[model samples]
Target: MDGQPGHEPDCKSFSYTSLQGGNIPESEIIVAKRKMDPKTFSQEYEASFESYQGVIFYCFNRTLSASNETVQPNDVLHIGMDFNVTKMAAVVYVRRGDQMHAVDEFVTYLIRQQ
Candidate 1:
């Protein structure tokens, strides 16, 4: 477990006995050690988002999967949008089978509210 603050509870929940001397195989124990300084490492790993730092998801990518493909006429298009007083943004995608393929994105800045 990490030695960072607030990680004490998580460290205590695991069975140290099993981790240290129990029936667990040495080969299966995945120990990830950091080579860099803690503060620098934390900043890069956290990517500025404290709450979602360590969580990994498949949909996070720079390039859309369906960027080169054409959306079929019958395909269902899904859009997710975020609206604020000064800014509005949206993501467009289509689902095929179990995977969601992003097609485009839109963003607009509002200078005046009506």
Candidate 2:
């Protein structure tokens, strides 16, 4: 999919194949197994998000988007809210280290428009 604006390209799903054909090496299989582990995957995601410095916000529709990675933490996350809309947003902050700071924050918006 080209990076052109308004281009809704087709999405592809993951296709898994059996390794009985001896095409996949043993080391590759081990790494794949570890990555497939739920605990390991979650921890890796958390680590990646934590290490990255930026403002992450999830929209009211449970959509997660991170932007302004260059912005500092002291800066209040700027959000545009529609006055005519009946909805609210929740922010999730995750910190790293013994004294974790606001490295990444997720904002989830909830809409209850009739």
Candidate 3:
């Protein structure tokens, strides 16, 4: 009758659900993979914009999952960016205001010449 608040183990539910048989659907798997891949690309784009304007980027490589931070009201936040070649990354800090403010940021990436 007791288990982790949201992670209760249901023996009956598992009895008929084998790992192989209960595999995630192909479409779902693709979605999950897409979510995980090129994760930094979006961040890089935003960070680049901040850098262009001489703003400092603060946060990078942050968790995508929603948690306390995601729900909290805040005046500042960290952003992450990824390069297209898997060689660059960036982070930026942005503050809210009349026109939005970027306090600081950093960028680094490997240059692949083709």
Candidate 4:
């Protein structure tokens, strides 16, 4: 679909970090960096796509939207709620024409309701 009309693809790049939601452990990241720079390791999302993405890149949903669309008050609103044991999050999208734009979002931890 490259160069196709109305084929706006979304690609979000995330650097590797040992913080929470980071699929790679600090030790692994450190080991990977032995042959590459820190910047290289952080941005290397392709090497372990199946392993890394399967774990959920928790932050991807927030900014992964078509930003050009504007939301009118009369336009239908799309609110999505998603949660797992580690975190809970919500995203708000507005449909303009046929495309949806993420106008706002919220993220919160402590997802598991105990």
> Cα miss at 110, model 1 (Å)?
0.7
Model 4: per-residue lDDT, tens digit, 1-114?
544555545634444434445776778666777965444455673343333332333334445533756567687779887675667677788876676778776788663457
lDDT for position 83 in model 1: 72
Give me the overall lDDT of model 4: 0.60
Q: Model 3 over residues 1-114: C-alpha lDDT tens digits?
A: 334345556622222222245454767545654764343333332222222233322333335321222213555666666564445555454544444333444567666699
TM-scores for all candidates: the values are: 0.41, 0.27, 0.25, 0.37
Q: Which one is best on TM-score?
A: 1
Candidates in descending TM-score order? 1, 4, 2, 3
User: What's the TM for model 3?
Assistant: 0.25
State model 3's lDDT: 0.43
The lDDT values for all models are: 0.56, 0.41, 0.43, 0.60
RMSD of 4: 18.7
Looking at model 2, which ten-residue stretch has the lowest summed lDDT?
A: 51-60
Best by lDDT: 4
Residue by residue across 66-85, what tens digits does model 1's lDDT show?
A: 45544789888898876744
Sort order, lDDT high to low: 4, 1, 3, 2
